[model samples]
Target: MTPQQEPPPFLGTWARVYWGVVLYLAAVIGVLMLFTASFRL
Candidate 1:
């Protein structure tokens, strides 16, 4: 008989959520940087 593999845990879900938040923050920071650079004389 073949051994059965266990399903992945909730950590994967948490990791995805964490990654999404990080990407969102990075996007916001990038936009702010662009805005500030545009305002510079």
Candidate 2:
């Protein structure tokens, strides 16, 4: 008997979701910084 190994199918989907969250957070932080900088100037 031989054992077979296969990669998980949800790996790609989860990776994309994780990246999306990171990008969204970065955008939000950037907007906040811009707003704060404009107010300070």
TM-score against native, each model? 0.61, 0.64
Which of the numbered candidates is closest to the native, going by highest lDDT? 1
In order, what lDDT does every prediction score? Answer: 0.75, 0.73
Clashing pairs in 2: none
Model 1 bad stretches (over 4 Å) = 1-12
The digit string of per-residue lDDT tens for model 2 on 1-41 reads 33334433554565676877899999999999998899884
**lDDT (Cα, tens digit) per residue for candidate 1, span 1-41:** 33333323544565676887899999999999999999899
RMSD of 1: 6.7
On TM-score, the candidate that comes out on top is: 2
Clashes of each: 0, 0
The TM-score measured for candidate 1 stands at 0.61
